[model samples]
Every structure is written in structure tokens, then in C-alpha cells.
Target: TDIPHFSTTDWTWAKGALQTVDRPYGPLLNLLHHGIGSTHVCHHINPRIPHYNAWYASALLKNNFPDLVRYDSTPIHKALWRIATRCTVVSQRGGIDGYFYQPKPSI
Candidate 1:
């Protein structure tokens, strides 16, 4: 299957709660959990920290290792649309060992 990949929106309380639940529950809970949205990357890096403190940890990571961290500042809706429309295929080219995807080339 061709899965779409895009940057995650900033973590907020509503976003964090939504991440804890399944996708179907997102729309209803996103606003309420928006604060937790951005700390996702931090959580993945260090699960020991509680969600409430993930944001602070994420900030430290971003500051210390900006290039290493995959922090996306895009708005959630816009990032979704961009991925849906542009990321159509996944491929691994020669010399590139890992699987990855890119947007379709412009005309």
C-alpha cells in the first residue's frame, strides 16, 4: 500500500489527547488535546516522560538537535492536503537504502 507521509502539526493539549486515541476519534477530540500535538516526536524519542512534559522535552531536543529532529510546524489541515495530493508513490532508488517518498515533480 502507498501510505502518505507528512509533517505533524505542533503539539497542543487537544492534539496530544487525540494521539492517545484512535484516528476515528481525532476530529472530536483534537481541539481538546491540541496542546499535546507537537510533543509527539519527543515522546517517540523518550517514552519515559509524561505527555504533559513532552512539550518541554521536545523543545530541548529541537534546540539542541534541530537537524536531527523531525519537527513540522505546518498546520494540520494543510499538511494533510499536501500529503494527500502530492505524495502519490513510495520508492527506493539506487544508492538509497531506506524507503522514502517525495512529491510529484512539477511540470
Candidate 2:
């Protein structure tokens, strides 16, 4: 994996959380989803944090690590269309580390 090495354990944990989780929806839906869908970043970073406390943890992560915390605001419907139309989700990165949906080249 071409995963970049971190200089400190804190950064390693934060970056790892960012890469592993995604906040797919806004706060309103987050409550409906029990934060698992919206505050997923914090959950992965510290699974010990309860769902109710996760929202706060997620806010802290976003405020402290704005660059690292990425919340995809794309409408779910549109995102689905994009996935169905052209992009076959390419999850395997051949030893690379990071989360992204890449399109496979059309055959």
C-alpha cells in the first residue's frame, strides 16, 4: 500500500479514520440514521463512543481536522445515478490505501 506514513500517532489515527469513514448526510438525516451514517468518521476512530456522543465527536473531528474530515454532500440520488451509469465501484486499489469510488474503464 502506498499509504503515507504519519509522523505522530494522533495524526495516524485521525487520518486513518478519515480514510476509512464517510459522512454521507447532513445533521438532520444524521439523527435519523443514528449517526452511524453521518458521524461514521468518529465511530471508526473511536468505536467506544456511543451513538449519542458520536455527533459531538464528529463535530470535533471536523473542526479540528477540517482538511482530513471529508463529508460528501452529493445528493444520494445523483450519486447513485453516476454509479449506475459509468462508474463500476473500484474498491481494490492494488496495495494503495484510501477510500474512493473510481470508475472502471468501459470494455
Candidate 3:
């Protein structure tokens, strides 16, 4: 429904990957890291030590969580991943519409 939100960390990671030269998923990685990495597009920064690392943690949670990971095979995940990574899953963005939208990152 929205442009898709992401944390600053997500934005940075995607940005870093995009900026890297000779990286396999250059275009797609950049898209995910910067394209959708936003407060509106992703979880808000943690009140304490809020930064890119926070979003990186978010990625880890989404990947390890069983229920969340299950969505990887679902159509929504399929479509989003395809669009973001261009069919290449070099990195993972965790959660769905509301999962980490207001993320309060753990220490």
C-alpha cells in the first residue's frame, strides 16, 4: 500500500552493496538497501544507538524466524524479493507490512 519502509541500517546496507563495484548483485542490492530503506518504508530507528546496524539485525531476525521465513515462499515475498533483488537473494529483508515497521532494536 505504501512505498515500503526500511530502517537507516537497511538503507545503508543496501546503499553500501549498491556502491560496491564488481559485486554480483550490484543493481538489485542497491535497490533494496537504498530504494526501500526508509522510515516510511521500514522500521524506525531504535531510540538508542539507532543506525544501519539496527536494520542489519532486522534482516537476521526475519531470516531466522520460522513463521517469518515461511513467507519467503509465499507470493508476496516472491514478488517483493524479485522486485528488490532482481531474482537474486544476495541479502535478506526481514518481516512484512507491520513486523518491524516500528522496530525497537535490541542491544
Candidate 4:
């Protein structure tokens, strides 16, 4: 199922929601902040949180948004976990300034 996949827009939405004031799933966000790393790392250790909002969106589609206790069991979540696990290699020497993206040069 090519469920539209996730895009940059989806990432924006997740970022916005993560910074919201509600703080319903605060711990999850914290875990993502502390446990997860860059997109490349997440792509291997676990791309779940990266695509976390997608599952949220999915639940909303099924009218089970509020019922979604967590996303740890979802495929997207597992994929993200795997990505994160593999991305973090201490032996790998590289810059952490922006592993997943680069900021545009200032004008």
C-alpha cells in the first residue's frame, strides 16, 4: 500500500504539532528528542516519530484519533526505530550541524 507516503509538508505539520502548548503526548516527544537522532539515523533506527504524525493522521481518518494510545506497534513506527538504531554509529565521523537537511545560505 503506497499510502501516499510522507512528505515535507507532513514533517512540517509534525513539527508544528510537537511545539504546540497542549502537551498531551509530552513523554513521546521527549523520547523522540532524547532517544532518536537525525533523519538519516531515524531512517534506520526507527522512522516512527518522523512519520508519527502520519499515524495520527491515519487514526483521524478512521475516527480513532483520540483512541490512539501509541504508535510503537505500527509499521511506520518500527521502520523509524530500525533507522534510528542503524544511523547512530559512533565509529562514523561526521558533522551533526544538519544531518538530514541544510540551512540555506544567508543572503
Candidate 5:
């Protein structure tokens, strides 16, 4: 994942692509949460956009980078539990320069 020629913006986009998950929880719930829960990837891509405009930006990002944007529909509680239980460890691949979350080992 380490590309030596990538600029800081490119690196940020790459990180956001890997880590940001915009979880849609209905319009009413999204409104209640001020769009943070649903338009999180937009937030990561550009933190300056006001919450009111994040939806539009998120849609734009989704449209332009369909392969890169991660729209996770998993319930918040379940995702939290999964992360808590299985995402604790980070390890670097042998001879690699970066660290990544280790996949959970099968029993």
C-alpha cells in the first residue's frame, strides 16, 4: 500500500478509503445524528464541509470513486462489537514498511 510517489493528499485519500465507512441509518436517524454517522467518509475526505452539505459531498465522492468509497450498512452496535473483539491487533508484513490490522485467525 505504500507508494513512494504519492503526495500527502493522496496518502490521506488512501487512508480514508481504507478506514472510513459511511453508515446510512435512514434519513431521520441521519438528521438526528447530524449526518456524522452516515457521511463520515465525506468528513474524512474534507473536514471543512458543513454538516448540511456533507450529504452532497458524500454523494459526489461515491459517484466518482465507487470502488474506493466504503458505504458500510452494518448496524453501529454490531460494528463496534466486531471492532472491539477482532480489530485490536496491528502488525506489519515482513519486509513491508507499513503496519496494518491483522486479519482474525480462523479457529
Candidate 6:
């Protein structure tokens, strides 16, 4: 299934949402910022938080750490295209644990 991309800055929410709602042929990816996707921010902060209560937990975090928590409103299809075209290389930086995508330099 094709997944929606939110932003180039951070794709944690998008990835998690895709994993959670992904289905055969096509996914129900339109349910953005809801269900597992909405609670993704909270999940990263506290893995122990259950999915049922993630939305509430996320709201709290959003109020406290506005800078740290990012919610990209970009449509998934656009973000996916941007990522696919720009994020061409996957390599580690600083150390093995620090992996990232690097765009190909313009000719």
C-alpha cells in the first residue's frame, strides 16, 4: 500500500500511521492525525502509553513541548513524492546509530 508523507523534517508519525493502517493493495491512509497516527507523538515519548489514550497524552505533550513535537499538515502523497525524489541516499552520519537520508546533489 502507498503511504502518505507528512514532512521531510520528521516522519515518525507518518511511518507509524502507515505501519498501523497499512493494508493489502491500498491502505486507509486518509485517516491522518487520528487513531494510531495521532498518538504517535505520545508513543515516542512514552512507549508504555496505550493506543486508546495516546491522543490525550499527545495533547498534553503538545501543550508542554510545542517545539519538540512536530505535526506536519502536508498531504501524504506530496510528501511521499518529495521524499522519493529528494531522499535518494541512506547513509550513517557521526556514528552507526545516526543514519539519515541525503539528497542527491544537483548537477
Candidate 2 residue spans exceeding 4 A from truth: 1-16, 24-29, 89-101, 104-107
Q: What is the lDDT of every predicted structure here?
A: 0.54, 0.65, 0.35, 0.34, 0.71, 0.54
Winner of 1 and 4 under lDDT: 1
TM-score of each: 0.59, 0.59, 0.22, 0.17, 0.68, 0.53
Best by lDDT: 5
Runs of candidate 4 with Cα error greater than 4 angstroms are 1-14, 18-77, 89-107
Q: lDDT score, residue 8, model 2?
A: 49
Q: Which stretches of candidate 5 lie over 4 Å from their true place?
A: 1-18, 26-29, 94-97, 103-107
- Kindly give the stretch of ten consecutive residues in candidate 6 with the minimal lDDT sum: 18-27
Model 2: lowest-lDDT 10 consecutive positions = 1-10
Candidate 2, RMSD to the unseen true structure: 6.2
On residues 16-39, what C-alpha lDDT tens digit does candidate 6 reach at each position?
432322111213642443455545
Candidate 1, residues 1-107, lDDT tens digits: the string is: 22222225434443343232112214434446744555655665666887667657877877996755554555656666787889866666565333457778788
How much is the lDDT of residue 78 in candidate 4?
Answer: 55
Once superposed on the true structure, which residue ranges of model 3 sit more than 4 Å away at CA?
Answer: 1-51, 69-107
Per-residue alpha-carbon lDDT of model 2 for 36-104, expressed as tens digits?
Answer: 877777888889999989878889988998876666666555656766886656454555454346667
Estimate the lDDT of model 4.
0.34
TM-score of decoy 3: 0.22
Error of 6 at 60 (Å): 0.3
Q: What is the C-alpha lDDT profile of model 3 across 25-98, one tens digit per residue?
A: 23465456542332111233232424455446546645664232211222334445555654222223456321
Model 6 — TM-score against the truth?
A: 0.53
lDDT of 4 by residue, 43-107 (tens): 23224554544444444533643332223333445545555554332221254211232223355
What TM-score quantifies how close candidate 5 is to the native fold? 0.68
Q: What is the C-alpha RMSD of each candidate to the true structure, in Å?
A: 9.9, 6.2, 15.5, 14.7, 5.2, 9.1
